[model samples]
Target: MAIHRWRFVGIFILLAILGGAAMVMWNFIGLLLVSFAMAYIIYPLAGYFSGGNRKAGRKYLTACLSSVLLVALPVIYIMIYSLNVILQWLIENFGMIQSGSFTEGLKSGLDSAGFGVVSERLGSELGRLISSATDALWTQVTQPTWFLETSISLALFFVATFYFLYEGPRLMELIKKHIPTREKFLHELMSTIDKIFYGLFIGHLLTSVIIAGLAAVGFWAILRPPLITLGFLVGMMFVVSFLPLIGPWLMYVPMGLWYMALLPGGTMPGILILIYGSLMLTIVPDFYIRPKLVRRDADIHPLLILLGFFGGPFVMGFKGIIIGPLVLGLAQAIVMLYIEKRHILEDLFKRL
Candidate 1:
């Protein structure tokens, strides 16, 4: 009895410590989850690179390389490219604003519309608003605290990814050993989770690639942007498509409008791109290809999977993309497992 009391006391102390840790590290939870998901998705690549070698050094090397190649490099490139593009656009627009051309044009348009008296006031207010926004943006960018936090988060993410990739198999075995559940039930749960991950990561990634490739071709044929610039833009669109309610249309539509408005004889190409993007980039891949690929691996309904993709982000911001589907998929798995073992459950209930 004394030993049992000590055991209970130990468990209570452990729980308290864990709860405190969770509260303290709450901000990092999303980054860790993302790291785990990335590690899971790229584990196969690490395995492939290992080539049957079970040596610890080989495992570490393969895991590190896989994390860098499959996750880190792409993310770094995207961040740098996006920042450069944004800076260039801001510089050009700032020049225009400083020259008074943009405000003058707006004021002239307002005057022609018979609002001459209000034009000056509106232009002045707009300029002030723009200046305030620019200042705010600069201030945010230059904040040392923000930069430090972001750098730490990114560093933790990469380190976590590498650790998970190297330790995944052992971690799974440890979980299996510790979980006090029937082996069959545990196996089924793991299987269900695996299928969900496959459906979310592999299906979505393939669909994005196909759509982005088509977009790149369409952009080249229609807009005639430089090849390198076209690739970067299309690549950015591919990443952006993962966000809820924003997809390739975020790029193509704006480009189409710019082409129609700014360039002579550009109307037909712009119209063609809008039509092409609607059919090829957005409609077909989203409705048909994505669903088909997801359903191939995940036994859950495609509509539910789609809901997870869109709804996860809505509920949990960016991380919802993985977490939302995972939660719903786990629920589905539990229901199916219960159905499969209803008789056993019924007999147990009767005994109780």
Candidate 2:
């Protein structure tokens, strides 16, 4: 019995060591996945180049060319340009504007809407509060540190994308080799991941394009910044919405406020309306559009989304929510299947 216990302990230690090794080695695999994601995103464009070539037999060279020149080059350029834009915007307008105090603004607007001398006093107090908030914001930011960080992150992404594009097939084969073929649970898990990610990948791109088009139209109809560039930036943010929860809100709230402020207002009421409208428009896509598109792959509730978004980062870091849920879901599916197959429902639900 002692000898058997020792053997089990030895096996557990070996598995732990292997897990540590895999964690350390994950960078290479991560790069491969990132490249696949990049290539998948631009596959349509690559298809344009390879579509004719497919008519005869098969031409992978067309795909390679399109991926390298069309997908890779453009994406790398955009990443660099975006990094620069972010750095520049930070440097230039570190605090050229602020929202001031919402409480104060509300008080003043209410007073103007009519409440006599009491309202005027409240508005005056609110003005001071807003002034205090805005006054604290005006300052010069040292941007070199920001530029350095941006430079490093983009450089890594570029390097990863480069190698990924360079060695795509071997990675796919490696993935296929590891995936369980015969198990019903494993097969279903694989199916869910492939279906969900593919839909999410395409649906997100379409959503971003649609949102950007709306933003551009709204901007052109009324605002300053150049259309093409602003549209691209906003569209990029919309794409980032794939991350869930805070990502969409972060992108929209500031822009919505900015648009409202820019609207020929001091009219206050109109600005309030605009702010409310923009917020509604921005928030609607997640509830309405995402439900239909993402429902197929992941039947995750919004509460689960919040937990995943927060808990994932705490446990596993930036991309954790994506990786964590995929893993947990697979395990859950496997366990559930086993329970059903063995007619172990009473045991399973009781445990739950």
Candidate 3:
């Protein structure tokens, strides 16, 4: 009896120590989670590469290639293209971006909106904010410490991601082995999570890709910003997919405003882009296309997904967005499992 009690105490102590360590490393936890999430997102590619044969060496090689294809290659292209666009924009419009014309235009818009007082306040606030930000940026440019820290963090992020991708399946299996519950229940929950993850991530990715292509074509005819930059912004709409109904508009409307308010002879094209984008890209794709894609992959309600998307970011910052939907999915799976085990639905139907 004493030996059993001591063993229990030892286990408890170990858990306490681990929990403390986890708390201490909470900041890095986000990086770890991001790596794991990336691994999960690209697991299908890894599987395809393995061709149903699970050799450790092959799995690692496949994981590396998958990461390169999905992440590294795209990022490199985006960076190169985006930097060129940015440099060109600065060369052409450095005077505009840094001048009072921008502020005067914004103030005029605010006055037209019957918010002259707000405009005055906004101007003052923006002046102060820009002053402080410029000073901070100058300091950072003159200093090397922050740059080094950022570089180290970025390196760690990639290293962690590489390992997570390579060992993700093994890690998941190990996690399942230790789940303190009936294997069936655990399996069901995991399966549900898998479905939800794929539904949200892949649905967002596909929709964003389509929207980016459309936006690139649309912007080619209007919106003076580089096609790549505009398309990149459109693609990044997936970041705000939690607020689905309004998110795309948040991007497109601003883009339209940039053209209308900034460039001469841009208002008509800007208005057209706004109307067309809101209708075709934002509404049709979000409400109709996205629902079909997500629902096909995961047996979840659209409203529930919206709630998870919105609520997650509110509660847990960015991580909450992913975690919120996952938690909701897990809860749903548990409820379904309980209903199945107890025949709750059948009982309710009979009673009715």
Candidate 4:
């Protein structure tokens, strides 16, 4: 068969177009990846809501509901609650500073330590710092460009998520149809990827829940923060726990320090809470249970999953949580395929 000369030209043009499109979309890569991941995670829920219906309206509605339930509501709740708690704490503390209570307390403590001379200067400096910080925060938050950009990004994210959920299966079928691969190998590869996704997301979620539960119980028993406040804080911790390195410690450590330094007769409870958090919240669940769960579901080594969890953020920021495990999991899958079909692969290579 004679090769068509224009076919090479067509291929070159297609490649150039794809490269240009990729460059244009590079800034939104994180947003798109997150949307895809969210859609993948919630697809089963979408399926359940659709009840095997193929109607476009039904699929769209189900995708919308699933995205909101699985992603939006929880994210909004965490952000709002965390911000409220932080703002409340700042307001109360600022009130104390304005009322001279905080400065008076600092002065008295400094006088006892022979540092009274510097207390006034320190208080004034702190007040100035807080004022400047508040001004800067207000300025940034009020920026029209920032607000517009954020709004647009959010809109795009939801749209992408909805379509991904609605069209994912069809897209997969289309891809499978075009890909030049044996059905069995492709199925195995896809199944492996699915298992890894399940292991990473579900395992992390369950670990967070378990840690949050432990934190709530510990707070109720030991620290004794207000019930509603404790719940809110624990919920925030649940979200933060998904991140590497910075977990419930963000809440517990500060609370521990506050207990030890601010409250009378709180040193013991503070120490106890710290110990409880370290052992129950951080060490056990994160290190042992999480990896075990991931290993069980993924059928990949716990060590690899752990590396992906911890090392991904270091390498690729937040998305690495998904990407790291996925990359490692894919590498594992490829190796396994090579091992299982070594003879065939070698024979093919020899023929080539």
lDDT of 3 by residue, 1-352 (tens): 9999999999999999999998987878666766666665666667667675444696657656675467766765775676567556545644554665655666677666555578877865665565465455556645868657656766676678777767767777888888755345556667767776666566764566566666666666665665545755665664544344455677778767866887677799879789878887788877887776666646555566678767987987877766776677667766766776555444445655
Which 10 successive residues of model 3 have the least lDDT summed?
238-247
Ranking by lDDT: 1, 4, 3, 2
In candidate 3, list every pair of residues with a backbone clash. none
- Note the Cα lDDT for every prediction shown: 0.73, 0.54, 0.66, 0.71
C-alpha positional error of residue 245 in candidate 2 after TM-score superposition, expressed in Å: 8.7
**How many steric overlaps does candidate 4 have?**
0
Candidate 1 lDDT over 170-193, as tens digits, reads 777787788656445556667667
Predicted model with the maximum lDDT = 1
Candidate 3 regions with alpha-carbon error over 4 angstroms = 1-5, 50-54, 76-105, 108-143, 172-183, 209-217, 226-236, 239-242, 247-264, 271-318, 336-352
* TM of each candidate vs. truth: 0.68, 0.53, 0.67, 0.63
**Candidate 3 Cα lDDT to native:** 0.66
What lDDT tens digits, residue by residue, belong to model 4 across residues 201-300? 6666557777887888888888677655686778888867765556778877877876777677889998997898889888888678787666664655
| Residue pairs in candidate 1 whose N, alpha carbon or C atoms collide under 3 angstroms | none
Tell me the TM-score of model 1.
Answer: 0.68
CA deviation > 4 Å runs, candidate 4: 1-5, 52-60, 63-70, 77-142, 177-183, 209-263, 267-321, 340-352
